[model samples]
Target: MSALRIALADDQALVRAGLRALLERQGVEIAFEADDGQALLDRLQDTPVDVVLSDIRMPGVDGIAALERLRERGDRTPVLLLTTFDDSELLLRATEAGAQGFLLKDAAPEDLHEAIVRVAGGDTLLQPVSTEPVRARYRYHADDAPRALFSEREVSVLRLMAGGYSNKEIARAMFLAEGTVKNYVSVILEKLDTRDRTRAVLKAITLRVI
Candidate 1:
C-alpha cells in the first residue's frame, strides 16, 4: 500500500514538530501542517491527505467546526481528534461531528501511529480512557427510570466500555470474539442513538441505561 499521507492541525508549533518527527519515523508522510483549523481546512482543499489529525481547541474554526465544514462539503476523509484533557463535552461534540477517533496529546507514539492506520483502514479508534471523564461528567444526569432497551450481554459490553476497555479487551473479559464485541458496540451505539463510543457512554449515563 502507498505510505499513509497525513495532515496535522494544531496551533502549537512544538507539538506539530514532535508529531511530524514521530509520524515520519513510522514511514508516514506529512502532507502538510496548519497552525489552526481554518488553515488546515484551506490546505485540505488542495493537499488531499489520507487522514487528518487535529486539535480540538484550535483558534478560529477549531477542530469541530473544521470537521463540520468538511462534512458540509461532503469531505469523507477520516479525522482523528486530539485533546489535552479527557473532556466529556468535547468528546460528545467530536463524536457528533463524525470524528474517526480520539487521541490524548501525550499518547505513546505507537498508539498514535496505530490510531492513524486503524482510522485510515476504515475503523474507529476510541480510547476508553479518553471517554471515561465524559462518563463521569455526565453521570450526574442519571435518573431512575425504566431501563433503556439493551440486552444483558450488551449492557455488559457497555459497562466494560465505560471502564475504558477496548474491543479486544472486552472480548477477552466477556469471553466472546473481538468481532462479536464490535457488533455489540455497534448495537449499543445504535440503540443509544449516538454516533460513537464516547457519546454512547455519555448518553447511557445520562439516561442511566448502563
Candidate 2:
C-alpha cells in the first residue's frame, strides 16, 4: 500500500518538527509543511496531499477557516484538526466547516497516527469531551407533531444521520446507492439549513423532525 501523504500546518516550528518526526517514524510521508493556513492552501494547490493535520489557531486563515475555504473550493482532501482548543463551540464549528476528524494536541503519537489513518479511510474521530457536548446538546421537540418536510425515505435517512451514520453507512443500511444517499443528505442539509452532517443531525433531533 502507498504511504499516506500528509501536510502539517502549524505556526510553531517546534511543534511541526516534533509531529513530523513522529509521523515519519510511523512510515507516513510528509508531503509538505506550512506555517499557517494560507501557506497550507498554497501547498495543496500544487502538491495534492492525501490528508492535512492542522492546528486550530494559526496566524492567518486559522484551521477552521482554511477548511471552510477548501470546502467552498470543492477540495475533498481529508482534514484532521490537531489542536489544544477543546471548547464545545469550537468543536461544533470545526465539524460544521467540514473537518473529518479532531484530536487534542496532547494526544499520544499512536492516537494521532490512528486518527490520520481513520480520516484518510473516510471515518471521523472526535475527543470524548467534544462528542459529549454534541450528544448533550440534542433537544427533542414536541412528540405529537408530524414531520411534514420529508418523505418516509428521507426521514429514515435523517434518523440514521441523527445516530451519526455517514453517507456510506446510510447507503448500506438502506440498500441505496452511495450517490443516492449523498443526494438525500444534501437535500436534508438544504432543508435544515445546516452546513454539514453533524449540525444537520443536531438540528433534526432538536426540531423532532427525525
Best model per TM-score: 1
Q: Give the per-residue lDDT digits (tens) of candidate 2, residues 65-113.
A: 9999999999999999876644454666787788887788888889888
Residue 85's C-alpha lDDT in candidate 2? 43
Q: lDDT score of model 1? A: 0.81
What is candidate 2's CA lDDT for residue 16?
Answer: 93
Candidate 2: give the clashing pairs.
none
The alpha-carbon lDDT assigned to residue 163 of candidate 2 equals: 46
Give TM per candidate: 0.76, 0.67
- lDDT (Cα, tens digit) per residue for candidate 1, span 1-210: 889999999999998999999999999999999998889989999889899999888878899999999988989999998876745457766767888778888888998898888788777665433445665565543343323588889888888776557799899998999999999898888777667676677677666666
C-alpha displacement of 144 in model 1, angstroms? Answer: 8.6
Off by over 4 Å in 1: 128-156, 159-199, 205-210
